[model samples]
Target chain A: MSEVAVSIEHVSKKFRLYHERNQSIKSAVMRGRRSVHEDFWALKDVGFEVPVGSTFGLIGSNGSGKSTLLKCLAKIYYPETGSITYNGKIAALLEVGSGFHPELSGRENIFLNGSILGMSKKEITAKFDEIVDFSGVEKFIDQPVKNYSSGMYVRLGFSVAINVNPDILVVDEVLAVGDTEFQAKCAQKFRDFKNQGRTVILVSHSMTSVREMCDSAAWLSHGELVKVGPADETIDAYLDSLPGASAA
Target chain B: MRYLKEVLASRELLANLTLREIRGQYKRTIFGQLWSLVNPLASMLVYTLVFAFILRVEPEAGDPSGLDIFAVWLLCGLLPFAFFSNVVQQGMGSILGNVGLVQKVYFARIVLPLSKVGSVGYNWLFEMGVLVVVLVIFGAFVWPWLPLVVVTMVLLAIFAAGIALMLAVANVHFRDTQYFVSIIMQIWMYLTPIIYPISLVAVQSDKYGGLFGTSVTILDVYRINPLERFVAVFRQLLYDNRWPDPQDFLLCAIWALAAFTVGLWIFRRSEKGLAEAL
Candidate 1:
């Protein structure tokens, strides 16, 4: 029997969009609640399992619900009906350091971002040096993160998030934040995680990354799971099925 | 209750976010956090000048003697009212303002609103310190019921949190709610007895002339206006130095419950969509 890290059983998420921007007295009086919404499902009936120590890649076009499914697995959004049970701690780099304050120093951001990621103060203190070292921002640790380049900011965020030693890591196309060299380093880290038998759920549009890193691949199309299997075969099938694959 | 407990369990994140807010607002400013007290102090100065000197508004004829009675009266009403209004308006933007943060974590969503309570509490505490200094300077220290003022401020905070939670939820799905909040606050301020005693509007209507552009006391409008009782409670206890009528607390309890329930319901309903929208 496979040791499962995460189990997703028939999950779905729906969103309501409003045509009117504001619900003020004037709008309510004049427009009378302007034609609000028909439901839009970001995900529907998605079911999957990531066994312990396996690297699973999710590939889909934008707005195809790959990221939404990852979010549901991360518990960022609860499923409408079905349940997701996670066996161990999951650290998601959904958006690298989205909470970074403009005026706070990089050192301060490490603590803040670490805590925001659910790390205790004691954990931060213990791993502080390693995080700064990994970020390669020791020279600018005291400088406010706002002054850092986007690449530098992502390095700091990724370093902190990866160092959390989470059992399950959820990465959402954020690995492209830094330069190619940094991207290579992140990929190497993923390899190490894979070698050490940690579970990873990666959402990316890059077919190359999916083939290089993932043991298995899943293709999501319009909130539905379209394909799942071994990385090479599944990715080959997905690419073959694309609109202009034969012509290209 | 289970949700509240879950939020409480994430108290560290709430405190961290609140600290971020307090520091972020004043981080690079010259005076830093001292500005919290400076703002309310400045408003007190202007109101004291306008009413005591320009309009020559006086308390009822048989009011007791005190240090610079105008300042006492103005502060007595303004302090609690400002605290509540500031918390509410500031909190309207709190959840939406920090939508970015909420998108990243699995922490309790209530942390967003509760953090507003913390930051506003910080501001109110600073304002309270200034109030104490003012009392000392004006020799208004002998009031026997001062402890109850603490209770009043706490109630105002609960009331503020309740309203803030409602606004935070509403503002997320509806952008215009924030703008409407500003207009509502302006009108609500006038309806509240912060600038002038509600008793003045209640008892001496004929003497004051279409008082405040109406032939009625704010007390007469209490049923429609929620702030009436909250302001009346503070005015009674702080300005008159007596226990607030218990009826005021009852009304506050109702407002608190209503705002909490509606706000929580809206937030829970809307929260699932926050990630995509943000």
Candidate 2:
């Protein structure tokens, strides 16, 4: 019961910063090389772990590697070194409904997006009605998603992702979506998730949400782990370290 | 081996993505699924007109089947070639086309290109079915050779998927790959014995002796193209209504296996960098 849900050990991800946006054979041939580029380490020897049944937050300023680290965890980006080990099914809610084909109806996309998030067709079919109800787009479910308002599209996407029922859920800044009522519904769902002893790994810049929801948090600065401890304390330390922030 | 396991594990995603491609291909069009059939029919008409009527490129009648329809013979080669080019062209752009999905989601990246093969293969099946109907109507006993036609189709799909996988990853790094492949495909089509008979090349090779006074004839060099072997196999099975030459069959299998192996090797080596490259 005390085992960690996910562990990140000495993880480092390197990115190439291309000087020129020349992605063509002609350009490479003319330059006598594959364009000018420099190696930049996005996540440098950063390490952290999320305990089973705990809500975990990764907090960092812009370009501090929090998102990059989360991406590495989600298997979107493979790290150059180290390893990320996780137990059970991991579903990432990064850019919800990203795989939805615009020409496909909302009803069809549910299955498509569900499968993309690693859900089986049987599981999607079982949860179909609930997904539709949660999105509140029942009337337009049979219509092509291109016709849906942007809000409806995202809501449907979020609904399918949240219903994936993964043991470990990785979310990135998607909590601020939908109207206020939908937000309340999502908050309630997160509470239910915690009650069920599942794990949630979140990447967010909103310190208030981190302090309120996360049991423990890791603060990253410039691709390095600055601190890892209780959520409130870590958030306070991160906030105080800001350039012009006053001591509360 | 581990990569294959990963791809196998994601078969559901591949199936769903393929369905998406099939359904979304002509969603807004008035004809809808009929467009799949109409496209090949339209091309067959144009080629039959130019090559058979104007150019006078008359291939000999099917031997045992005794079917002399130029359009049918043209289709036997044209359909498979169309499928191959479609898979390569679409699969090359598959990763780039799904930038949102590739960047945000994580599944076997191979599924992107493989799904293109599946979708295009679906259309190819329909085209093949229509061709079979035409053959039966023309009094050709294609039923006996149907299994070989399927076997050849599978080999061609594997070969095309291999090329597609390599091109998909390469296209991610170099945006020009798609454009470059388009030109190559057009030239490649002419080089293959699709419109003209392979016998024409054989006769020309005999007349010209050898290439640069060497022993390698033009036909020998031409058959080096894997697609030539595939077209010949399809013609032997579907058009000629007979067992294909064992050498051609073995060579098709070899080219398919080699292309798939090399393509997958290249794809795996560069796959980790695709998200960043895009």
Candidate 3:
């Protein structure tokens, strides 16, 4: 792609699987070592480029390192081997309301969560009403979020992450949150995001949605790249490779 | 230096997080923020009863101010030490307490501990304000020395933040750090001469010559504790209404800067691995 939003070249991530979850100094001293751990490679030389303004989907089976790769893109985890370079601001929706303090009111958490997501006070202020309106929790904004139903909590979180308005949006499986009406609203928001020429990268298990929503896709299996191509063809290949899939 | 710059750029987030802490601390309580004052007052009463009344421990009257009240004298040292302890304890847990946030979001991680300091420091100011008012009512001329008290308080806060930052990172790898630090803090409180007077140690040191027949006097080793110097400076400024000893002031400044620099260095080095370790 001529105008790339994100370029991931030869990225590899390693995780340490500790034999014993020994989180104590005494045990460490007694054992004469920190802990016994085996290095687990979560992502191995995975490389892909996301084009500007395009919706890119990552499809993989469970434990396929898609989440780890998404976290690396979000800057939450640093890759052990390679670098991920991106232009402009990037925001990640790894989990809805991850930073919300349950005791704070919804209005306060909006500001708290927004700032944690890298929006300035002025930016949050400008988008405050839009966020509350989108979440449809304006009536209970003053009440502490501990009283919020799980759906309302997730909706508010998703709204703030969406309104952050970054050059690149990194989303995990959080797309499946909230009711059908709210999900429809989110679909329209994503459409608007695409129309505004912003990059969107998501990880999802629903092959149908991946085929419908993504312009291009990448398939990962066991910490390696399986294929990167048009969304329909890649999803087809991914499905066909499954143990019991009938050839179309 | 790049990390410091990033933290400064995100000062707004720091402010918001601090506000969240201050607001959330007293939520759902019947007394609300009033408990802040009540907590110190209750401790003051208990310490006064045990040390001043029953044990017959007597602290000399304030030199220039002639403020002989034991309760007032006790508070000047007690308040600062309490603030220091709160900052260290709370800041040490900031990262571990917010595991969900750390794992999911990307921000300057130092903000977590620094915000703890800010929130507790805010409460410290209010507590000190009440103490100053009480001192004035008790005929102590604390007006001229008020600025110096503020300076000393800032230094103590920096020192506590540094220690807290170090412990926060340690606690992530070893869960026992918190419990261990709590025991150490209790012993440290008594060691700092908060409830008793430094004069007691000085008198004993003079009578015995030195500790265990060594060249080093007991008083020499007692002064080595940074909190001792902090409490001495606070007592000199607010209780005695005078400038602190130049040596004590210099030592406090050194401790504050050294602790903060070292704490920031440790926190930055471990910031990346924090998400995974948790």
i-RMS, each model, one decimal? 2.4, 1.0, 1.0
lDDT of each: 0.78, 0.92, 0.93
lDDT-best of 1 and 3 = 3
Q: What is the lDDT for B238 in model 3?
A: 92
Predicted structure with the largest lDDT when compared to the true one:
3
Q: On residues B10-123, what C-alpha lDDT tens digit does candidate 2 reach at each position? A: 999999999999999988799877788887899899999999999999999999989999999999999999999999999999999999988898888899999999999999
| TM-score of candidate 2 chain B vs. the reference | 0.98
In the predicted model 3, the residue pairs found to clash are none
Model 3 over residues B140-168: C-alpha lDDT tens digits? 99999999988998999899999999999
Candidate 1 lDDT tens digits, A1-248: 38999888888888766666444556666876655677888888888887899999998778899877887877787778788888998888888886788898998788788878888878999999989887888999999888999889889999999988899999988878688888888888899998988999999888888898999888889999998888998888888878998752
Worst 10 residues of 3 chain A by lDDT: A239-248
Residue pairs with backbone atoms closer than 3 Å in model 2 (clashes): none
TM-score of each: 0.88, 0.97, 0.98
Ranking by DockQ: 3, 2, 1
Q: After TM-score superposition, what is the CA distance of residue B152 in candidate 3 from its true location, in Å? A: 1.3
Find the candidate with the highest DockQ and give its number: 3
Evaluate residue A71 in candidate 1 and report its C-alpha lDDT on the 0 to 100 scale. 79
For candidate 2, the per-residue lDDT at B144 reads: 88
Question: Chain B of model 1: TM-score?
Answer: 0.85
